[model samples]
Target: MNALVQKSTASLDALKRIHPLMPWFASFVLLLPLPLLALNDYQIYLLNVICIMIILATGLNIVKGFCGQVTVGHVALYAIGAYTSGVLSVKFGVPFWFCLPAAIAVTMLAGALVGIPSFRLEGAYLALATLGFAQSVEIYIRVTNYLGSASGLGGIAPPSIGNFVFYDYFRYYYLVMPFMLIAVYASFAILRSATGRAFMAVREDALSAAATGVNVRRYKLIAFMLSAVYAGLAGSLFAHMVPGYVHPNNFTVIEMVTLLLMVVLGGIGNIWGGIIGAILVTIIADLTRDFYFYQLLMFGLVIVGTVLFMPKGIGGIIDRYFVSKRFVAAREKTAEQKRAEAAAAKSGES
Candidate 1:
């Protein structure tokens, strides 16, 4: 009995020891094939989209998943990023390297601005306001000629590394994957830090978090800005991927909702969950395109099913299943040992 307890304890400790490094290793293994594998243009394009979406989802997860903020306007920040890079690259002839930081900074400021007033409301009200905010941004894009007036900035060029241009989707895939990994790592690092704990605290209970000196407003703004940064970077990468085209209409309220869905489907508050969920959802959405009208309906049903059955998202469901399986096995083993001990005692008594 004592030996079994010690064995179980050791196993738990082992899991704890390896848990930190596991995700990083997994990400590398999953993404490493892009540069090495012989993938076609379509597959590369899909991977590019997946990588970009994962970056966006990870950012959104910071606000919606980690901090528990209901931001349905995340794509507005993406639009800001897309426009910032697009306009600069097309009009000012700014290099992609320079435009990338500008895009992130501009989007981060936009997020901070939106976070200030919109945060006054909570729950469904906040969600509604965010939805409105996204719509407003889209409207502004349509009305402002400086932002291409809905036509969006075109003729954008691929990023050049001193004359070496990334014109193909495969090259774009390699370039974008690094940023995605970095953004994902940063998201997880933030969650593991003291600031991350504060965000989680505020999410779990804002008043209590404030009472504990978490500076809820500051952290909330931080979450929004961080999320914006991710969106901006993803948008910049996305621009380079498309090379010559962009549309303000792409950053609609529906896009924000889709991003939110990715975070939810991935598992709110889990880094890998957000990434995995984004990939699965992206793949499913792409595959369903063959169904035309029924594709969207089916997608909605899948989301509903995930919420109703998985509850915690597919990743969470799988995690729970594994944990439950291991726990049940351990319990059964303990029970068997107890029964064996009891029989041995009874035999001695006889």
Candidate 2:
């Protein structure tokens, strides 16, 4: 066992030394040809959906995973972003470039509003509060004539550069991919910084974190706001994607549940886990679309099974495997040193 672990450790170390960024580089390279290799536009469209979900899942992970906040209204914020951008472009004739940043700013303010409840509530109370917020947003949109009420908002323009418009899945994929990569990279960078450590400390024990001079409320708000920025970006992208429409029904409780599932299935707090979860959930949803009657049942079973048998999610399993290997390698090294000392003593005595 020790030998096997030592070999595994050595292999991993060697791989890392060879190229620390190799995995990321390889993934980028592989995905570059996806548009060309795709059999049709549907596949490209699915890929675009996956990219947007990646941003959503990553943002949710920052708050729920890193900062330990329970917020179900994330999708509501997402809807706000979509509508904000859609309205700006449709009503005011704002360019897509300007609408994107404006949507993020608006969503950040909304996110801060959502975080206000976290200061006074927690657990089920917090969840209920956010759920209420989400419902309220949906009702507001549904009843407001300016937002198109039940008919929804339409006529949003696609992003463009001069004469070039991202009107098709192929062009839009290029647009979304860069933003997704940057979001993922930025999340990873933030989680590795001092602020990230404070967020994790609070998650582990808020009282202890407070005692250590961490402002629990501030970090929590920051988490929510940062996550809102991600949702806003994703919303803007979705709003501009093919069809260029935004509807109240698209951002309801059902959508919130789906976001939660992505986080849970991916392993809460695991960055890669959220990405994996998004991709898997999207693909599974597509495959099970034919059996719409049993879709919710199947998703429920999957979540239950994951929680019962692999609570850490897939990322947790990977982490545990590597941890065990390192432990075994350390033990083997210690044993080897003791054996060497013993042999030296025996030789000296002889």
- Which is the leading candidate under TM-score? 2
* Candidate 2, poorest ten consecutive residues by summed lDDT: 21-30
TM-score attained by model 1: 0.86
Write one digit per residue (lDDT tens) for candidate 1, span 1-350: 64676686676667558896655566677778855564567877888899899999999989988899888888888988988999899899998999999999999999998788645877788777777888888999889998789677788989989877888887787788888888888887899999899889989999999998999899999988999999999888887676557887678755665676788788887787888888987887778677756755665776688778877886697678668878988999999999999999999999
lDDT of 2 by residue, 154-237 (tens): 999999999999999999999998899889988998899998999999899999999999999999999999999999999999
lDDT of each: 0.83, 0.91
Candidate that would win on lDDT: 2
Task: Give candidate 1's whole-model lDDT.
Answer: 0.83
Clashing pairs in 2: none
| Per-prediction CA RMSD (Å) | 4.6, 3.0
**CA lDDT of 217 in candidate 2?**
95
- Model 2's alpha-carbon lDDT is 0.91
